[model samples]
Target: MPSTSTSLSPLSTGLARATAGLNLCHENASEVWHQRPPLDFLQIHPEHLIQEEGGTYRDQLDDLRHAYPIVLHGFGLSLGSCAPLDQDYLQLVKRVLKEHPEAFFSDHVSWSSLSHHHFHDLLPLVMNDETLDYLVERIDQAQELIGQPILLENISSYMRFRDSTYDEPSFINALTERTGAYVLMDVNNLWANAVNFGENPLTQLMEYRQSSVRGYHLAGCTRQQAGDGDVYIDYHGEAVHETVWDLYEKALRHFGPWPTLLEWENHVPPLERTLQEVSRITRYLNDLSVAPGAT
Candidate 1:
């Protein structure tokens, strides 16, 4: 069976020990591990894992799996969509899991489709009772079909509807309560939303269902002042901001050392750059742990 637990899965209560990773981008595939840096895992978007020849990377992936832990962070699941679960995609994911039973899977919490039309973006869902019930039902169905629990990620959104009755944390916690699923918290996305919507991330997300959050994602954002006002887009193209890094430290102080992933997609720097951030976060996490004989 597919691995349902993460390296720092919520099964443990105390502070997470030491888990850090980077997104598996094709750009750095050739120059991976500049001098073989220390990393705990690799966050993979399986859709991109396929070879250019339109064939799966069974051998290539298996070879890499031996060296590092792999976790699937997908974008196409569209777990919150009203449309029926994508059976073909689910089967593809299942095959992947079946081969690498140790690898875990997760997807965004936002909807990307309606009535069979895919929007190709992770759009925000209406955060209310109707949408909550709708999503829980879909997640329940998805879990049963996949035969494994999945983590829901908080994605970046450009707009928020007036119909959003519950705040992001409350809605996420509610979904976990009903579905028995875990959350893949994204610190960059949280910081972006707070900037765009005028909320305090340190306090606004203070009451998250900490026990259900096993991992986190941190990336760079691109800011823009549009007709709609200021916005911080999760461009994932630049180095992580100092502001976001400060917020991340607060989160580490508050939530303890959750397994954090350094994400770089668009303007991916050299493999060495990602390793530096990974080393930076790993060191910070080591420091975040309660010191030897503290108050």
Candidate 2:
């Protein structure tokens, strides 16, 4: 049985909390546990641990809980949806956090559900004042229910809404200003969007200083044919791109080396191979630590 406490402690509240981490995948979990890769913390989608309805804990979750500090990243909240927040989903999230009270949880700034239908991919939001107000209300309710502030991640968007009033950083800044939610800055997604949309990643990163960014996601994407042009899809199925790594180092210089996790979801690889990606993060952190003017 898990604890019933509602207290949520800040895991990476301070600057430079940890350098490298891995997203615990279901397929490689047993091997990861047996091999015990060197990670500062382990992240999991809490949706994987508890059943949607019964809220029962899986044995694997219990095992992992005893091994390392957990960070919960979720995709089902649909925080930007016009459809009301799913009470059952909120309950499921609350249940997991109650047990792993030290864990900090996060979800996307986009929607996955519309009315009763659920989409497999995270869809983009309009990014206007109307959407911002709706998200603020829902995020407030969720924080009240979950007993802590939530981190919201920016998703990779294929297209932008014409009526959007704010740029990505400005939109996220407004949300953090209004609701006090932290950010799980996905550097790869930023790079993907930059490539797909003709934007500058480093410039946007400097503008992202307004939010409380506590974590980072580094992953690879696929370049797919979009008619006559090439669009980068955030597949998270390959190695971290060189462009993303360059931006990540700039981000570390800007954001002070927050807990960075390597997310390899699609074609999951061996634990050692996965750790190699994490090792890159380690090398960057090591260099940054000794760099001039670094604290």
Q: Please tell me which predicted candidate would have the highest lDDT against the true structure.
A: 2
Which clashing pairs does model 1 show? none
Best by TM-score: 2
Q: What TM-score should be assigned to candidate 1? A: 0.86
Candidate 1 per-residue C-alpha lDDT over 1-295 given as tens digits, one digit per residue, 9 for 90 to 100 = 1222222223322223458888766666545533445678776676665434443344444455556776778887788776788887777777777666656678988988788777868999889998888887777776766667778898898788998999889999888877777888888999898888888877756868777776788899998888867789999998889988888887777666777899987878878887888888887788876655321
Per-candidate TM equals 0.86, 0.89
| Span of ten consecutive residues with least summed lDDT in model 2 | 1-10
RMSD, every candidate, angstroms:
4.7, 5.1
Worst 10 residues of 1 by lDDT: 1-10
**What is the Cα root-mean-square deviation between model 1 and the actual structure?**
4.7
